[model samples]
Target: MKTFTYRTATDTAGGLEPGAAFLAGGTNLVDLMKLGVATPDVLVDVTRLGLDEVTSLEGGGLRIGAGVRNSDLAAHPAVRRDFPVLSQGLLAGASGQLRNMATTGGNLLQRTRCRYFMDATKPCNKHAPGTGCPARQGDHRNLAILGGSEHCIATHPSDMAVALVALDAVVNTSQRSLPVSDLYRLPGDDPSRDTILDHGELITSVDLPALAMPSTYRKVRDRASYAFAVSSIAAAAKVADGRVTDVRLAFGAVAPKPWRALIAEEALRGKPATRESFLAAADAELAAAEPLKDNAFKIPLVRNLVASVLEGLTS
Candidate 1:
């Protein structure tokens, strides 16, 4: 093991330096460092900066600090009542022990679950810059089907982020507040970068806007627990008199970012909450999907799952 130094940061400016990295729960960062994927010379601890409070905002929404644990956020009554999709997504990830240590901000920014990215020996653009992505031709069943580029096909693996985007949450940073919708970057040309966050900036809190809609998060994975999503949908809708008033949808494990299905939501707006409308919306969103040879199954799977979630929201 190489010798590395650890320091406790009093503030963001003083603690998180140019080359220094923040130590949240150390669940993902530590594992990557051990795999030789990430090697930081200095680990700046930021848990003691009083960033672990969960409070209700005056606007009838919730504000979760960056240091708040996943287990705590998942079990909170306010989150369960207003943002059930978030609670469901969090509970579906990690074990009891790991969730107890994983932070909310860290969970949103978790890297892809791509096998090539995890294995340093392989050619993964996410793991090693300029190294060509081998998964574009090799085992790509679990790879992205939408918004993928020739450079990389690794999917975004955060269930929490998918839920947050559908809920229309905003990410609070030291520089300025960034809407959670604008945080992710599409894989149009640069699949190497995942998010738009700048260096030396830390996520302080997440603000969920007030909504009078019903929402749910559905994830289909290989296992029942502790597994990354194969395809997931987060749907929030407001229905009145059997007509869809508003709709917000985001998909996971199908793209480089939380794939927000704007076309689907637009199709559902002002339409009756019927199976026909839901299927049409799903078809419209999946029309542009370009799947690889091995992952062609994901195209139909994602379309069907999106329709199912939309149908369930009708009630």
Candidate 2:
């Protein structure tokens, strides 16, 4: 690891000094630093900035401070009652100890679990641009199958963000407010940049809209607990009298970011909430998947997860 300076910010202001990075819970950042993937010249401690509250908004919305702990957020009564998917996703990620230490903003900014990106000796375009992405030809059973590029194929590893997408959550940054969906970016030709936020911008809070959607988060992984998602689904459906009135679905561990299943949602609207309709809707969204050698199973995994979760939500 590189020698670095550390400081704490009393207020949210000013662009980051060159080569500076924020420090919240340090759950992910510390690990990356140890692996040599993140080598910042200075660590700005924002844990004391007082960004750790969950407040009810004026319009029945909920505002979550970026520094709020994962475990606390999951246990919040309002979250469990109004945004079940968000709470469930938070509980499903990591282990009990990690959930106690992880922060909402840090969880949203997790790096890929791709091995190549972590091994400093390996050639990974995401770690060092133009070095090449060996995962394309190597072990990529858990990498992205959608929104990837020749430059990289790493999947975002955030269960919480997937649920946020389904809830139409908005991210509030020091710069501006935008939909949580717009926060992430596709790999395209540049895989190093995971989010569209300016390098100096700080995420302050996340806002869940006034509209309510009783939803759930389901994750399939290699193990029963403390495992990264192999394929995960966050789904919300509105069905009345055996007909689908509305629906929302988002996928994780199958794309570069939390993928909104827009096609599937569009297909299921006003349609019968039956097994056949669910499968067709799932298929419609997955038709564009471009899986590689080892991860092709993700396509079917995501498809089945979407169908099954939507069925449960509707039934």
The TM-scores, one per candidate, come to 0.96, 0.98
Query: Which ranges of candidate 1 are over 4 A from the true structure?
Result: none
Residue 206's lDDT within candidate 1 is 94
Candidate 2 RMSD to the correct structure: 0.9
User: Which residue pairs collide in model 2, if any?
Assistant: none
How well does candidate 1 score on lDDT at residue 217? 91
Question: What tens-digit string does per-residue lDDT give for candidate 1 at 181-288?
Answer: 898887656666678887767888999888678889999999888888899999898888999999999998999888899998898899999888888898899898
